[model samples]
Target chain A: MLKVAQPDRPDALTWVFLGLGLLLLPVGLYLALSAPPDVNQGYLARIMYLHVPGAWLGYLAFFVTFLYSLLYLFRQDPRHDRVALASAEIGLVFMGLALVTGMLWARPTWGVYWTWEPRLTTTAILFAVYVGYFLLRGAIEDPELRRKAAAAVGILGFINVPISYMSVKWWRSLHQTQSIDLTTGKIHMDPAMLQALLFNLFVFTLLYLGFVRFRSLLAALEARKEEA
Target chain B: MKLPVEGWPEAAGQGRVGVVRRVVLLALRDLRLEVRDRAGLLSILAFFAVMLFIMALALGPEEEPLRRAAPGVLWVALAFGSTLLSTRAFALEVEEGTLDDLLLAPGGKEWIYFGKLLFQMLLLLPLAALALLMAAGLFYLPLERLFLLFLTLVLGVLGYASVATFYAGLLARLRGREVLLPLLLFSLVVPVVLASVRATTGLAEGLPVAEISDWWQLLLVFDVVYLTASALLFPVVMEG
Candidate 1:
């Protein structure tokens, strides 16, 4: 008989994860304090700092999901699987906030909240691809196979992320240009706005670490509860 | 690359079968199992019909445009539908623990993979023929491009079955693979789909093969890349 085992709880890493969680609160406040109103877009640009970092982290979180999914395949450990799941969940959170804040910011900036431009289109596809992964997981009954299959989906689906972006660029449509504007000598935002943006970036990264730890702990607890 | 054939216990135990009779006997047993239920033929045919019906409704009397679209439509529909069916070729074994039995038999997992791949390729042929008929009648596309179109479909199916079947092994062990298979497959297949669409559509537009050679070559390249990676990785992905 094949014996499948659960992962034991961590000691030092647990404390480190908790410490990172504690640090996020201060970092988040600094970003908000540092970010001043934009001379160009006014206070509205303040949202960009929160919104943009969230968008960047959204991709970052998903790629983490991909990496851990691969690691789980190699190690066959449930902890990595939980990490992948946690990253995916947090990625979604940030992605959602990014879109909502973008919409809110856009109501004044672009005169429209939703547009089918490449950024939006690619984002929509990313959203769809992940949703499909969840759906695929729901259909499987075996826990082990479920992890393996979902891992493959995580790896394969990354392909569309690029095409989804390229489709916007290739066809030449309504989507906005690249977000990282290096030209014009510098980013066209007020110093106050930059501080706030920077603060939000730090806050969110801390928040992400906190969430990943909490989620990992929950997964571990769930395992213990199941055993009991 | 040859392991010592010294003791059949350890060597044959490693999953290679030298006895022709034993391999043939196993193949016969597999064929019997497949024939007992007709699972492969049934699922592929069922989806093939559904795709044709939907395509007809979607096109709706636009025969000229339909003719050009037929190749792409057929290939995409076929690629997806075949994935649905071809995956199950080894599914029953996986589910019932027969897979372990086979793995412990004469040849190991690689032999099992080849057997399943071969079976699926054969099963897809008839469905492809049926789809070709539907494409011709519904879209009113001339069969004059039969050689080129069939060439594309054959290679496309070769690509589809090879990769799809390997992924099936990956999916076969998992629960809810019916949904996961298509998702994983479609992502990996975008490049192949692009090349196939280019080739089929270009030919459908009456462009000579030479004019469309670029797309054809791309499709061939994609097929080779997918096939090599799939064949090499099938063991690791499926077993490891």
Candidate 2:
């Protein structure tokens, strides 16, 4: 009655992705340095230019994934799951970026590369949660059950987003609270810093959209293959 | 094999009460079987007790560190013990083909999910309560925070039960359900795990209520969020 994947629908996506794929590094570099030097931390907090945005966008992708997962749960349409899986994979990728970029930044600023600082620890846990999500999905054989299990994790995993957002306030930790979110930090930023942060936020938001669309397109293609 | 959602429409259109009643009834039946067999409850309790006992030996009678760790140890024990118990719930059902029949009953896939989750909480709460008592008494903590302890256990188990039940349903189609169940369960329960541990540990340490309020709030939020999500996601497992 319903088709899970329809790969033959078109090849337009593949070409568009190829073009975008070539452009990632240059755009990433542009966003990385576009921000001004931090007065407090100097060039180091500049790393926030990348880490914060990656974490922000990862949550955005997963947040969207959470809603569509509900749709899959509510509607029982495999396509919704395909979209969610796509989003989660990208979420996972961006989480990794957040971690890596944060590490590179942390090494120069925080002295030691890591601590169980609430924010960093919570972010790490989120990554583990999603990695475990993909692992559970891969281990299961029944396709429908795989979708269900992943959706369950998708929803559970996102619950961490708010906690991550609030972790600094929730627990005393070494990591400085974000200069932005009202939950943890002093909410004022110099206009230039705020401008750079806002710009990077927009760029990352665009990046997330591109990644999810591409990943979902790939999911649709993968489903089409299974159908074939 | 019949799915639980395909049964008679006797309670049709009765709204929330009817739905809740059906869910409670389903959970009650499972609980009865569990009690009679003593398999689920005994196994879960045995696992929790044995693990706690082992940790006591490992950590020695040193009170300070043990008190610091008491909350986390108890939660970990309960999480793993219930994982073992609830994995068996569906494994036994699938083996007996009862799960298929249950799946065919009246209601949506969510009723089955909610029922199993409720049954899990019922199954684990007492054992968790017992373990918390043993740990508190042995560790020689002031017994004044029993209410707080109770609150922590309720919210923690609620979170764990919801997650474990969802994974059990998901893992029903896979072999080696026991191993896969815990792996899937804890991987997703970190937020709950964090909130619960902090709440319990703070209570054990006799921290002021104002200091630990954040964790309590976090636990409540986690329970609501995960339960709602897993309840909604139940249908996906059913379709598979």
Candidate 3:
């Protein structure tokens, strides 16, 4: 059952995360701007600072949704469902950011804004899956059924994240391979650029944490109002 | 209406064989009902014919373009047509208020998902074959490799139906499910569609089986993953 007794305001930790992330965002930008130019693409490659973090956080957020969806199914808790919903919503925003930034980067680099390469295609499908998640949530009138259905989508849709991440390796497409390959624990990036990218990733992750918490709190309030 | 599945109550108690029997009974019953109610099946077949004709007309009278387009056109039609049939899988149960009864049956609800999936596969496979033949004729698609093409159909249809049946069951009670099903389905099953289309094209091109096996492997992976995930989730989602 949903606990309508949840606190109405975002917690202190949320404020801290949001503040720290906001404080660091500009610094991250400065670092990204000042970072060494790519040996090939030059300063145009700076988009990776935003694009990589946005995509990574998108994957992370969806993974969180997946975990919470599973928890909701096993535990039958509306709180878990709310978290899943909030995370998915946040994930969509970050993923959209990644896609747009990637396109901007691609036009100057790959000479086309879009290609049907595996990584791009898989990522687009991943985006659509979450979009459908929200659509499903909106169409259902019953809260319980809506939650169950959304959870199922959340779980199933996360399947594409790994596929999207690995599509570069699997298909050897036009999209460049990961600079920081998680599977192989390899780093093929300059230390200064890697540092800036890592910092941006950290800041973006903080913002994501803050946003998800705030959104989930709002969802809790909405759920409480719906019950009232 | 009385539950069409005979001996379902005792069927669960018989262990491994019982689950298999229950699945077959439910599937066969649905198949019989679907066949008896010819309207849905006829419309889907008609949809395939009309769609293939329009596609051929739009892209065609030219052989090379149509041949290249055949696999994509065939799979897209199959994907769309199956959504119509997929909804019908649970629409009858929901209409008659028998879905709850099926859920209330004595054992695990996984079989219900499997049964509905089997029903979709059974219906879609033959229709797919017919659509393939239609494409072959209209689009200059080669079918000298009939057996390989059929293999592609089975793998592809299973991949598509596994997710479709699961989603149909999920959205069964909603008013706007018909519209929503395809939206959700197309996104998740793109890989399956992509692999199937590629495999079909390879077969049509007279590629070696070794070349086409990669696509087959991909389709098999999707089918197995979707089937397992949906089976596990079905009972949880269906429960009140």
Best by lDDT: 3
Per-candidate TM equals 0.71, 0.80, 0.90
Cand. 2: chain B TM-score = 0.90
| lDDT for each residue of candidate 3 in B1-240, tens digit (9 for 90 to 100) | 012245555664588987888899999999999889888788878877898899999998889999989999999889888888899999899988999889878767889999999888888888998998898899888999998899999998998899999999999988899889999998888777777887888898888899779778877878888898999888877877
- Stretches off by above 4 angstroms in model 2 are A1-21, A27-46, A74-77, A163-168, A173-210, B1-9, B13-25, B35-43, B205-214
Q: How well does candidate 1 reproduce the true complex, by DockQ?
A: 0.17
TM-score of chain A of 3: 0.87
Please identify model 3 stretches exceeding 4 Å from their true place: A1-5, A162-190, B1-12
In order of listing, the candidates' clash counts read 16, 16, 0
Q: By TM-score, is 1 or 2 better?
A: 2
2 or 3, which is superior by TM-score? 3
How much of the real interface does each model capture, measured as fnat? 0.20, 0.47, 0.45
Give the number of the best model, judged by DockQ. Answer: 3
CAPRI quality level assigned to candidate 3 from its DockQ score? acceptable
Question: Candidate 2's residue-wise lDDT over A1-228, tens digit each?
Answer: 112234554345544544554565466556557656665666666667677888987777778778787677678788888778877888888889998987786665555567556667667777877787788877877677777777777777776567545643455432244332323322245677777677767666655665666666677777677878
